[model samples]
Target: MEKASSVLAALFGSREPAEAAATVTSIFVYPIKSCRGISVPQACVTSTGLDLERLQWDRQWLVVNSKGRAYTQRVEPKLALVDIELPMDAFKDNWEPTDLSYMVIKAPDMEALRIPLNKKCAAVDDISVWEWSGSALNEGNEAFEWFTKYLGKPSRLVRFNTELEIRAVDPNYAQGYKTLFTDGFPFLLASQGSLDGLNELLDEPLPINRFRPNILVDGCDPFSEDLWKELKINKLNFHGVKLCARCKVMCLFVDDTGWPWSVLSACKEMSGREVKGCCCREPLRLLAWAMEMASNAAADHGCRQPVSLVLRILPLLGTVPCQCTAPASASAAACAPLSCFIPTINQENGVTGNEPTSTLMKFRSDHALKLKKTQGKMFFGQNLVCKESLLPPRGSKTIAVGDPVFVLQKYSSNVDAPI
Candidate 1:
């Protein structure tokens, strides 16, 4: 009992047993849209999204091009390489910035850029992301030059102007909720079980960062989040608005290589599993291909890992060779090389291919939407809109890593649409 208590305390910072069906396993706040995320033990759940008190709020900042359009990993894979950091005390609710306080930004071959936390900025209108357009505060010349050199194009860093704009969630989904520079919803909730189930169908398992979920939960059945219409954590209620349709951004390589993975190819092959031992054999080939692709991409980026080391790991992965004969029961198409199905490199973005999306389409597509004659899409996570406190002094709720998640209400079936 003592040992178990120690382990629980180590993982969640509290030894209390969960009293709900699920526990919040992780909390991530992306201060800047599409940049790296900061994992926190606890965060204030605000009207917009998870926030680190006085330091930064989720998606409060954005990188924009010369035309004031947003730049995301989908357009510039190099954004994945950009890193953001803040002082440790910044996460505290009461921490006040001293004269030395700064938000440090770093990227490859670029000197660290520091922006004072208390610095004032000029508000600029014309910044836009996805379907929302509004005014935002410009971070100034230093940030401008830093991003321009890193992205190799005219770029600027802008903060969403809270005082000037109110970007509301689509009325068709959540009537009155609002968000900042997020792709759409304020909160994206994912389940560890869902990721585990998806990883079972993947060649190399992906990290939770691939989904960029703000709230990640555990101790739930795979895909159960899809049916979560309403849930609560701490003192806040979160309603599932739309089923999050994954984009190419999640397929981006999670390594320093800056190469995109073939999610389409991965999903198509791993999801099908039509051939006997396809999971075992095909994955081996896919692993080798990914390694080689990563190696080549590294070389392109002027950084290369030892190919010999990659080869050494290959033998440990499986004895399966690139050349393998399919069983009699399998179709001829099943035996074709993955490269034949799709070009190994995307000509437009230099991505190797696609996965999970192709696989997800087989089983996870919205059947209700399809029946309704609406354009159907494959979904992985749930888009959430918080039901903030109606009383005075709103956005005071805080959610922690070990907080128990209660399902207040849920759909009987995932096939049913929330709207």
Candidate 2:
């Protein structure tokens, strides 16, 4: 406790009392939905989301089916294998892409496809993502044929028509806040401390990519973003409106081959390459195993308290397991230290579950008193809506790595409150 206090004092020596003293550690922008992300040193904070204008904006493009429905990693795990890139200079402000400038896309067993950055096409109507159904700019027949061939299905690449459509965030959360093609809010912010905390419980630690956060921060305690109702970064205000609910996409195996586990066997059969190390895709059972592992960890930690209790206790201890000495009474046997046992679960190839998501549910579930009204769901990061969008003279706001983060306001009760 003394060591942590000294560290905090040193860290916050230059910050105001209201600030949490965190800093931006990383920023990522997904050019295409359910595809690989590009890490940038800085990104323009737009009303819709992160943008580089003529280069790439987060989720500005979507891959749709013949029915005009969006295809994501959920339904098509192979989309994880799709790699997209643009010129590094494109991320610079006011950088323009010439006629020859293109966004190159590559996939396993497919030729590289390059689409002009400024390419325009006739409006394709009835394209849908979640509840929003509207017209979008088609990426031409060549782009369509490429996706169809790569995905082994009828697919079309369509760009969002920002001028014609206004997709509003749910009024119940943050009124008038709009997003491009994100699941809900414009920005998702996560804490590195939270990831490290969860990683301690997993047999194999998962990367931040699994959560797909737009902004990643460090130097704060685990899950501190949950209590942050309002914050400022790079002179722009960001309001934490809701907790980010996770889905099955995080459980899918993303290998170096960029291919999902489901296609490895087929790739082996066709290409006759050695496919010995990859784990089989078990989306359903993996989630179950992750939950079971977390439950077991909690049980073996010498305490069987509810998740909310543990969360409430985390801030004081700077750790998960209780730090009390071993109990002497028979009735208090459950109060033992977590170090008493080592988890024997093998994670190399025999492991059946995904980490972080499975463990996040054990502590960040909606069953807590402060979150009970929400639907039963597992949460990780905080969904943010920039206040600049709601203010006058809205202009491009830039956030870069190492920018100081200040918490201006917070919820009265932590999400860790007991139910």
- Evaluate residue 238 in candidate 1 and report its C-alpha lDDT on the 0 to 100 scale: 72
lDDT tens digits, residue span 1-419, model 1: 99978863443333223457699999888888877778988877644222212113678889998878777654465676677887866666556688799988887799999988777789998887766777899999999999999887899999888766877778898776678888767898999999999888877666777677899999999989888877778756677878876421122334333323443244235433211122111223223222212111110011121222110011111113333322322221222112111111232233535565555556665552353322334568898876652223453457889989888667776557453
Candidate 1, superposed: residue stretches over 4 Å from native: 1-19, 47-56, 247-352, 367-376, 389-391
The 0-to-1 C-alpha lDDT of every candidate, in the order given, reads 0.61, 0.60
Worst 10 residues of 1 by lDDT: 294-303
Model 2 per-residue lDDT tens digits across residues 1-419: 99978864443232344555699999988888878778899887754332212113888889998878777654455676778888877666556779889889988789998988877678899887765778888999899999999877799999888778777777888776678777667788999998898788877776777677889999999987878877888777777888776531233323333554444444345334322211111111111111111111111122222221110000011112222222221111121111111011121222223455456557765654247454334567888887767554454567889999998767777553221
TM-score of each: 0.68, 0.69
